[model samples]
Target: MTEERVVGLLERLLQAKVGHDVARLIEKRLGRKLEPFDIWYDGFKARSGLDERRLDAMVRERFPTTDAFQQNLPAILEALGFDRDTARFLAAHIEVDPARGAGHAWGPVMRGGKAHLRTRVPKGGMDYKGFNIAMHELGHTVEQVFSLYRVENTLMAGVPNNAFTEGFAFVFQARDLDVLGAGGADPERDACRTLDAFWSAREIAGVALVDIGVWHWMLEHPDASPAQLREAAVKIATDVWNRHFAPFMGVKDSPILAIYSHMISYPLYLSHYPLGFIVAYQVEDYFRSHPLAENMERMCRQGRLTPDLWMKRAVGSPVSADPMIRGAERAVKSLLKH
Candidate 1:
């Protein structure tokens, strides 16, 4: 079958898996009654502005599916401005595994000298969610690579916590299209980014609220059953959904909370997404004015830095919601202004 046909098939599969509500909402927005095939086809093609042939080529070129990630690691590292020795050190330690459900970075102070990565995402997972996961893993890998090879000592060679690293990962993940030289900046691409940014920011912000509430609930009801946890999660999720998303959806349900996979594995990771969004945009803005290489290396080298210190050093200010909120607002305004 042709690549477009494959992409279409994947999209249909995705829509089928996600549920009718999401599919219908997307269909309406796209100005048609949506079919499963349209989910992947329309959504992917819309954001990327690339047909199957080009998208496949781009993906293959960038996401190395084998041991050869070693070869690419140096270029990526060097692009972010690592020194030659540091780049080589990172290249030797970049491990690509096929064992993970998605992707991950296990590195920086483990007994092993190298960082291991797993890239076993489900098929058709190449959509925005999958890509975001991929880029976030890339962010983690880069941090691992930098801290292990470039930092002064093992003690300091890593991020202080998962959220801070996730913040960096979020920053890199947002740049996936830009890094790949895909469609961006023009009217079509800007519209795509705006829609995605809106969708992502809204979805994640709600999840963050749910996560916070769930944690507090968990703390209070330490012996809460899985069912109780799930029930409480649904209530919290519905609350956030009603406040933020009900206007857009015209419906409310707690099943939405059940859909967040991270809620099961990483209880607190949801909060990091929104925080990462803020940090990513802040870093993105900084990279706009400063050279990507010099600034990024300096930022990475300051391993395990406090969030406040890291933000000040990298973005010339403390971490705040202003960057993401303002950037998103401006993106919307620009689209409306046009």
Candidate 2:
């Protein structure tokens, strides 16, 4: 079911030629023709316009030390609608630490041990990117706490897969600006956000196809050397780009998709990101009409169901691109009018 849903969405995306149209729109927005590497285009995001140094300054002031961030976790949770008791409970179980590398969450394997949220914080302070990553990891820690301490079965103390946790992390990451109390309410930004999400989903879907295709190529040439594998990787990435991206971007056989470091280090793991985005969009939409803190608690406590069942239980729908596509279409129309 999951495979069919993902493949079906990919096929529909290709057939609809939405990428070509969106590319033209993006070019208009940028005042230049699209480049092949524009597959990673981020100009639609509201934060793209903000000065990075200014944002970093704000974050550094807010979290001057790792302890500052750790101390504010309860307040952060409460700002997201958690009651004081629940916020304190979550904050108590999560230990924030400065990371030696790019940040990640480490959930406790046993009860009573704390979940670690690690993100890089320089000696001076936490930068904007570090703060953003910390919020994402905090989402993972929160979900870990709920799924571990709140679930009925100890054996089932996690979400179905890493993708679901990534989804939850994305939900928190999306609210980073809100947590900072930085942006005023703007309905127009919602449309921009939808377009941003659609473009992102399309970009990662192409990368995922390349990732999957390379694995299949490896299977076909079992005795292939490292040099041969490198060649095959580039070929596979180029082929995928031609099929999915060339028509839209006016480029042929661009090996740009092969640029992801994960293609070298993490085999067949790229699909989870696009899947996470899909699940995150659905989860975010659901939370718009429901209480995020309460719904997230109930959903996380569901523990280790199949992905489809977990999503259905959490959002009353299976994981699908329909909502994102529909929303993007409306956004595109609205954007063109203005």
Candidate 3:
């Protein structure tokens, strides 16, 4: 889709009304008025107040080594709502590895090859953080396996872009607590989850718009000096933040939007992330009532279609911010009452 459509949808979600609701929600949680840095507020997460060390201890007892987690991969998938047969199939086609640094998923390019999930495993054991990363990477493998082996075209064996795959990963990542037997379907926690999805999308949407602006600037000023480019980028970032973020955040001309290193290293790829957040919210919202295993497989099999088409065929609606905003509005209203 055109950047214009994406921009319009993101802007619609970033409306001052929704921003105000988000501010109120944050303030309610923090027992204070909004601050400039409240833009990174994560109090909406279900695990924000839970003790991480207790979780780590629990995880270590359950999975004291990489092999322990690898062997229980099928059980983890089953815990995330997949059936036994499907979970076994997925687990059989995926391998988990110990990593020295950050975690990531690497899908096999060849047919019949297993996907590799890499996560840091301390000598002491696999902690909660490592297990969470494994869940996210396992989500990627789910998409990769279905899209590659279960689709019509292995040649074009992928979703439309990076966003959709990343989207699926978020779907699984968000349920890490549920897998650990920590999260539940309590009304307040569910609402917090919905609002967290919307708020995250809102935050990244501004940074993404700034990314788009910098890309367009480079296109228009191919001959400009590096210093000139820097000046224009900062200007674009401040303009976007002032317009979208300042009204609620009470921060003016904040160049934080342009501070992402992706703007420097990746070049025009930053938009994929906000799109990922939106798609994840959309997909997770749909699966709330639908059969997740069947529908997730069905959606992945529609490989590489136009995003809107894929969304329509998968969910009943097009990819828009309305659902997210409405969900947030309901969440904020519900949360502020208590």
Candidate 4:
């Protein structure tokens, strides 16, 4: 059968099983219809005149210091309510053996272990992207450590899935600036941050949609050939691209979505990107007012606590638009105002 025909059949099967909610959610958030070629296109270029180079630089300059990270841990753990023993345990996990190459996380809990953090910098990255990734990974490590040892059981340890963890990870990832001592409530920089947040939210939200739709398609079309699955993925991605980001790029049929290796290797991980962004916002808000002592270890212990319970107990709310979309919008608006 032709690729299009096979995809159509797959979509039918997916809709039958997982329902069309994923597609509908994508359309609702994006506020438009998706074409088959708009998926992977970067949507941020149109706003802020920012480029990846600058962002990368920002990440590199920050997040390499044990002292800087230490200063922030108390507040971070306080927000999560971690204790001393747990803090030490988590600190040990993130002790930076240095032998472990860059960008490595130990154990499922990202915090209980240290990340190798392979920075592009010859002397070591001192830029935003690298720092962002490091911090992002740190957030993952924090959540990982908390969930694994802090929480009750392995079964109840982290959030629901990769998407939930990703959300928590993004909370720290977005804080690269604050961690680096460069970001804050400054008007101009805050506007930049706002723009970046919106752009990222849209981008990841789209990716999550694609991830959900593709999986739903896969689950339904068990008999679908790999080639057919690839085709379906492309179409969905393209459709997503045009719907949310087409106007900014002024281009269509971008093969960008094809690059999401996560879709192929980590089933259901795509949802985490957008979910992580949302969850991160909520967590950040929690830290804005709340403060923790040297209890990194205590926070690390609360792993996998269902999204609902974790959010309610951790921040006193259900996981919803407040942390994801609404919270983001508020942060962006505040940033823009300054």
Candidate 5:
């Protein structure tokens, strides 16, 4: 998609209903004006209601080490919607290990090889944070296994791009609390989730714009030095931050957006995250009446279809953020009334 089209699509979340309502909800929850650090806000998350220490204890009790998590993959997959046979088959094709750093997934190229999952497991045990990251990585592992082994042609073995994979990661990560049996369904909980998705998507949209802006700047000033590029990056970040985030946050000219290493290392990859979040929301909504594992198998096997066609085939609609915005609008209004 073109940068303008992507930007325009994401900016819808920043309008009167979704973004502003999230700010209001945050203000009410915190009983204070938004701080710069509020960009990492967690109050919208259901787990925010639970003590972190308790969650850590629970996770450690369940997964005292990486091996424990690896062994339980079948059960975990079953809990997430896969039947026992499918869960066991998926688990059989995946291996897990401890990570010194953050969690990640690596898939093998050939059919006989396995998908590898890595997550941090401390001397003490795997805690809530590590488990959450592991769940995210598990999504990637599952997608890899399906797209690689299940597809007819190994050459067409992945989704549209990294954004689609990230979307899959988000799908599993969003269910971590539920997988632990620590989450329940209710109107407010559902509302909070809707708001959470909107806030997070809106949060990344500005950073994506800043990334796009800096790329355009670099192209126009091809001969610029590192110092000049850095300065231009800061200016572009400030412009994006002011236009998108400052008003809602009541914080002005924050250069936090400019500091992401993705600008230097991955360059232009930040846009994938917001788009991924949009894709995740759409997928989650599609699962309301549809069975996830059935559709997941059906969709992941579609191989290299374009994202629009892939989404339309899988969910009966093209990938877009309108469903999330509408849900967030309904959620915020309902919560406000209550």
Candidate 6:
């Protein structure tokens, strides 16, 4: 069910004429023709054009130490609509630490243990990227707490899969600017956000296809040498790009899809990202006018049901790209008309 829904969405996105139109719009915004690597375009985001140095300075001033970020968790949760007690309970259950790597959330294995959120903090303090990552990890920690501490059964103590957690992470990541008091609600901005989500979803979907194809190639030629595997990986990536990305990117046989480190380091893990985006969009849409903290607490407490079942319980529908696609289409029409 998950595979069919994701693949069906990707196919529709690839075939949709809006992909080309949105590509042109993005190119105009960029003041250049599109390139194959533009699949990862960031211009539609509000922060894309901001000076990183300025953002870093702001973040450093706000969170000069890991403890500073940690101390603010309750307030952050409160700002998202959690009551004082609920916010404090969640904050008490999560521990923040400086990470050696990018950042990750480590949930507790036993009751009465704290969930850990590990994120990098440089000597200068947490920069914008680190803070953004911290917020993402915070989302995971919150989900971890809700799913574990609030769940009725210890056997069902997490979301169904990584994609669901990733979706929750995105829910928090999307609100970084809001948390900083840097932006507010606007119809145009909301529309752009939808388009941004669509483009990102479209990009990773192709990369995932390549990831799947390359693994299949490996299975078919198990005796192939390292050189042969590398050649096959590149060929599969190029083929996937040609089929799905070339029409919009105006480049053929681009190996850009194979550039993700996960393809080499984390076998068969690429699909979760695009699927995460789909889940995020659907979950976000469902809670658009509702209280996020309350609804999120309820949803996470559903615990380890199957993905389709969890989604059906959380939202009114199963995981599908239709909501996001329809949103992007409306956004495109609205943006282009003006």
Q: What are the Cα lDDT values of the candidates? A: 0.59, 0.84, 0.85, 0.53, 0.86, 0.86
Tens digit of per-residue lDDT, candidate 6, span 1-338:
45656567667766677888789899988899888878888877867756778888888998999999999999888877789999999999999988899899999988899999999988979999998889899899999999999999989999988889999999898888778777687777777888888899899988888887888888899899989988888898898888888888888989888887687688878888888888898999998877798999999999999888999999978777777777788889988876
Clash-forming residue pairs, model 1: 11-40, 12-36, 12-37
lDDT of 1 by residue, 1-338 (tens): 23243223222222222223343446656787533223133351244555656655566655544444445667655655567876676667767666447677777465366677666534433344445466577678767777656667767777655656776676566566665566455764554453454345445666666676677788999898989888888888777666555544556553474457686688666766655555666676677678765566677777777777777876788766555445544555455455
Best-first order by TM-score: 3, 5, 6, 2, 1, 4
RMSD of 3: 1.5
Can you write out model 2's per-residue Cα lDDT over 1-338, one digit (the tens) per residue?
46566666665655455566678889998798889878778888867767879889999998999899999999999988899999999999999987899799999988999999998889999988888889899999999999999999889999988878999998898788778776667666777777787898888888888887787888899999999988888988898888888888887978988878696589877888877887888898898799999999999999999988999999998777776777777778878877
Q: What is candidate 4's TM-score against the reference?
A: 0.63
- Residue 129's C-alpha lDDT in candidate 1? 44
Residue 183, candidate 5: C-alpha displacement in angstroms: 1.8
TM-score on alpha carbons, each prediction? 0.73, 0.94, 0.95, 0.63, 0.95, 0.94
lDDT of 1: 0.59
Q: Which consecutive 10 residues in model 5 have the weakest lDDT in total? A: 9-18
- Give the root-mean-square deviation of each candidate in angstroms: 9.9, 1.8, 1.5, 8.7, 1.6, 1.8
The clash number for model 2 is 0
Stretches off by above 4 angstroms in model 6 are: 1-5, 49-54
The Cα error of candidate 5 at residue 258, in Å, is 1.3
1-338 per-residue lDDT for model 3 (tens digits): 88788888778878838668788768776888776667778888877768989999989998988889889899998998889998999999888888888698888887879889888878888888787777788889899888888888887687888889889998998889988999876888888888887778877888889888998999999999999989998999999988988888776888888778687689777778778888888888898889778899999999888889999999988887777777787888888776
